[model samples]
Target: MKISNETKIGVLTAFAITIMILGFNFLKGKTLFGTSHTMYAKYTNVQGLATSNPVMINGLQVGTVYSITTDKNMKEILVNMTLTKDVNIPVNSYATIKNNPLGTTTVEIRLGDAMQYLPKDDTIRTETSAGILDAAVQEIRPVLGQVKNAVKSLDSVLMTVNSVVDPNAKNNIRGILENLNKTTAGLTESSASLNTLLNTQTGALAKSLNNVSSFTGNLANNNDKLTAVMTNLDKTTTNLSNLDLQKTLTTLDATVTELKASLGKLNTTNGTAGMLLNDPKLYNNLAATANKINVLLDDIKTNPKRYISFSVFGKKNKSEPLKYPLPDTLNAPYIILQK
Candidate 1:
């Protein structure tokens, strides 16, 4: 059968329109053949939720967001979710709008513990979760403030450095660097000298080291003698430590007290030694007696016949006793006058 072109054109246009309607409904999350139930949720803000977004139950996609609308008061947004007929949501179940990291939003349904289920078209509770971008902004806020403070601190430090580095300070720094260079050169020379002094063949340090080594060797060889000497020293110290120092001190103190008493008696002229020391008359009499004895000896030497006339040939010379002390010319210089 040959159809007319006008009829064919009309049929094709109608089929295309029908296909577009079906596709539009599908895109809007309307089930074409399968059965679904509509559930409602109200929120102050839908958080960018839109129709055709997936509706999830425990991370499983069970439905889609059917529509979003505002109430008559326009203070709240009402969301419609079309869930599969098989999904039995309990009473008091809630829905939350979730934003994915990839910038997509979904409606998540939470089941309640009540045995009774919510009827279709009933409005469930709604909540909004913080998106990744919002959370990131929240976390970075303090860090941004800290970065800003660090920048300010850096700027302040730079200003301080600029203020401190003046022309005089620069010259002083240069001078210090020059002095440090001189010191470094001097240290290098000293190091070389030290190396020379440490030479093993010809250096005094080597000779000193050799001497020390020899001394140590001698000490090692005399180790037994040293030990004996040390033992003797220990015995001497022990004997000294064992002496009765307290008894000696007590005896010495008694002797000192006796000596002090004797000295006190001597100073008081109460004893014979004290009288001899303190009486001037007695001292003068003794001096006189000694002078008389000395004069008699001088007279005897001058006239030997006065002492003995035993020799018959010798003249009988009568010598009177010397009334005063005769100054012996040989011994006169040895006399000491008593004041």
Candidate 2:
């Protein structure tokens, strides 16, 4: 029998549809030809878990997630997994969802050591694990904040330093340092000159000091003689002080009193001395007699042959006559001319 073209197309289409169905089931990890153990787990969050995500045990692919749905209460997510019949799990095992470095999600079944096996439809305990990126981000978060604070503090310190330091202050400091250097140099030069001057004067200064010392030593050595001289002077002063200066002064006073009394009596014209002082006529007679005697003596000096003759030859020498000077008419006091 020959088949129609429509029938042949229908049969090919049916076969293609069957192949697509099997392929879809294979991709969903459903073993249509074999049997598997189904298990359940509940979680608050799924973290992008989906059907057909692989389930593993010890890095071995043992099953896949079969379905995920909300529970009847709508409060928790419920996950159903289809495990291989050969992979038996303990009753106390956990189902943990984990994210990989590639950002894909998977479920890992951690087996427990209990002798009793988990029933096929029982719920497993659920957990979640952090990815590499998440753990790294968590570790670096605090350190990033601290580094930001340190950078801000360093910027503030730089601003303070910029405000405090100025060009004028730097110039003033430089000038001060220059002056100090000049002063130090002057002091160094002067120190050498002073040392030279001291060296030159050292011997003279020492000799002068030695002379002073010797003078003082001489004074010290003559201290006893000085004491003796002072003692003699003290004794002379004491003896002079003990002398009767009052008695001598009294004798002098008595003699002066007697002389004054005699002077008074003579001035009164009561004695010969008084008569001589008071009598003007006697004084005139004495004055006339003195004038006569003076004239006679003068005549004798001029004409000696008239007054005396030499008898040796009984001859007289002729000479000029002696003339007497007339006495002055004014009365003057008697003043004797002494030879």
TM-score of each: 0.39, 0.38
Which sections of candidate 2 miss by over 4 Å?
A: 1-6, 71-74, 130-339
Error of 1 at 175 (Å): 29
Q: Distance (Å) between predicted and true CA of 126, model 2?
A: 1.0
Candidate with best TM-score: 1
The local distance difference test score of model 1 is 0.85
Of the candidates shown, which would achieve the greatest lDDT relative to the real structure?
1
lDDT of each prediction vs. the true structure? 0.85, 0.82
Model 1, span 1-339: residue lDDT tens: 999999999999999999999898888878889887888888887777889999989989988888889968889888888886577888878898887757679988888898988877787877666777888999999999999999999999999988989999889999999999999999999999998899998888999999999999999999999999999999999999999999999999999999999999888777799998898989889777777677777777777778878887877786576666565533342366799
Segments in model 1 whose C-alpha atoms lie over 4 Å from true places: 1-38, 41-103, 108-117, 121-253, 268-271, 279-281, 304-321, 327-339
242: Cα error in model 2, Å: 99
Could you give the C-alpha RMSD of every candidate to the true structure, in order shown? 14.9, 28.9
Deviation from native of the Cα of residue 203 in model 1, angstroms: 30
